[model samples]
Target chain A: AQRVTQPEKLLSVFKGAPVELKCNYSYSGSPELFWYVQYSRQRLQLLLRHISRESIKGFTADLNKGETSFHLKKPFAQEEDSAMYYCALSLTGGGNKLTFGTGTQLKVEL
Target chain B: DVKVTQSSRYLVKRTGEKVFLECVQDMDHENMFWYRQDPGLGLRLIYFSYDVKMKEKGDIPEGYSVSREKKERFSLILESASTNQTSMYLCASSSPIRPARGGYTFGSGTRLTVV
Candidate 1:
């Protein structure tokens, strides 16, 4: 079975500090990973995907197949970056279903 | 921009009552999904529809049924609402082709409370 695990339930960091949200996945086939974000009173939205290899809002994630992990990272955390982050995995076959992690609440404090 | 809309932002109902949560998408997507979000448990898929009148059970489909009479609308029905059923329901839509290439579009989510 495919599964996504985000170890931290809550993470606090001061503004301008580096932030890293850990994510680990379990799957048998080639993995497709993604990072989703939900801000206060905002709908959940896609932040980045491993395949795109593009940074969004100064955040980037690299798929580490050897470690079976895809950690989201940002060089400098901003106050506006406080939100809930979820890691997801796309099923390998033709279906569009996704398995999501429990999510991590990131709080950037002043 | 692709848009997925849920009918309500918040709702409260009594136990054993029948509940209906409606979702509509203007993007004409082929895939629509229903999920319930809970603290610590994350978001668990309740059900999904691939086409008109076609539905599939997701990870957590118990106590729930679905209807998709039209391609643009997907409805989740709780046969008998229970206190444990209270949750934030989210509706999402995505294209079947190359779903990995493009991420899903989500709604504002309906926060349902069963008292």
Candidate 2:
């Protein structure tokens, strides 16, 4: 069974502090991982994908196949960055159907 | 811009009542999905449609049915709404471009409460 796991239910950091949201998966094949964020009262949106190897909103996630991880990281946390973040994986041979992990709620405090 | 729209932001229905939740996408996406979100469970797929009139069962398709009569619309129906069915229903659509990099465009989500 393929599963995605977000170990942290809540992560808190002071403003300007570095933040890391952990994500791990259990799959038998190559993985395609993504980070999605949902702001208060806003629609869920993609933050970054490992395949892109690019940062969005100063956030980056690297897919570590050896460890089966794709942790999201940011150098400096901002108040506006506080939101519920989810890690998702598409099935290997499916029509883009996603399997999401229980999200991690990140709070950037002052 | 990819635009996905849900029919309602909030809804209330009585137990055993028939319910319908509609979603539409303007981006001509080839794939559309319905998911129910809970506090700690994140999002669980209910059903998905790859094209008009084509439907597939997702991870959690029990107690839910879906329809896709046209290219832009997908509907989720509950034959008999139950309290456990109360959740945030999210609709997502995405094109098949760059399968690895393609991220889904989600709607604002519908908060349904079954009494």
Candidate 3:
């Protein structure tokens, strides 16, 4: 079974401060990891995927196979960055079903 | 751009009433999914379909059912709505033909409240 765990429910940070949302997964095979973001009054959207290796909105996540972690990080938090972030995992040949974490509510205070 | 659209933005229903949540996608993708979002639980997959008339039970399929009679449409059905079922419902679509690197396209979501 594939499971994703996001330890933090709420993360508060001052503007310009670095932000990191932790995520860990349990899967026997190589996994595809993604970070989905839901901004205020907006639909949930894909922020970044591990396979893309491209940063969107200054957010990046590196998949660590050894630790089975894919933590989302940003160099500096902005007020506009406040939103709900969910970490998801998908296993190859697993029908592309996404197993999502509990999610982290990020609040960037100005 | 791919667009996945949920039929409703909000819905209020009484307990025990039959409820239906509809989703449509214009990208002609082969896959469609239904998920429910709760405050701390994130998005829980309720059901998904890979082809017309083909459905798969997701992680939390209890108290819910789905139909995919058409290639572009999927509908989630709640035989008896319950308070515990009140939450934001999201729909998404993706194509396996594309590189797995391309993530899903999601709908705006429908906020359902069962009283």
The candidate that wins on lDDT is 1
After the best TM-score superposition of candidate 2, give how far the Cα of residue A54 lies from its true spot, in angstroms.
Answer: 0.3
Docking class for candidate 1: medium
Worst 10 residues of 2 chain A by lDDT: A90-99
In the range A22-82, model 3's lDDT, one tens digit per residue, is: 9999998988999999899888888989988999999999999999999999999999999
**Residue A70 shift from truth in candidate 1, angstroms:** 0.6
User: Which residue pairs of candidate 2 clash?
Assistant: none
Question: Looking at model 2 chain B, which ten-residue stretch has the lowest summed lDDT?
Answer: B93-102
Clashes of each: 0, 0, 0
Q: Which residues of candidate 1, in runs, are more than 4 Å off?
A: B99-102
Candidate 3 lands at a TM-score of 0.96
Please identify which of the two predictions, 2 or 3, would achieve the higher TM-score against the true structure. Answer: 2
State the lDDT of candidate 2 residue by residue for B1-115, as single tens digits.
5499899999999999999999999988989999999998999999998899999998899899999999999999999999999999999999876843349999999999999
Candidate 3 global Cα RMSD: 1.3
**Model 3 chain A, poorest ten-residue lDDT window?**
A90-99
Q: Is candidate 1 or candidate 2 better by lDDT?
A: 1
Q: Score the docking of each candidate (DockQ).
A: 0.71, 0.76, 0.72
- The best candidate by DockQ is 2
Better of 2 and 3 by DockQ: 2
Docking class of 3: medium
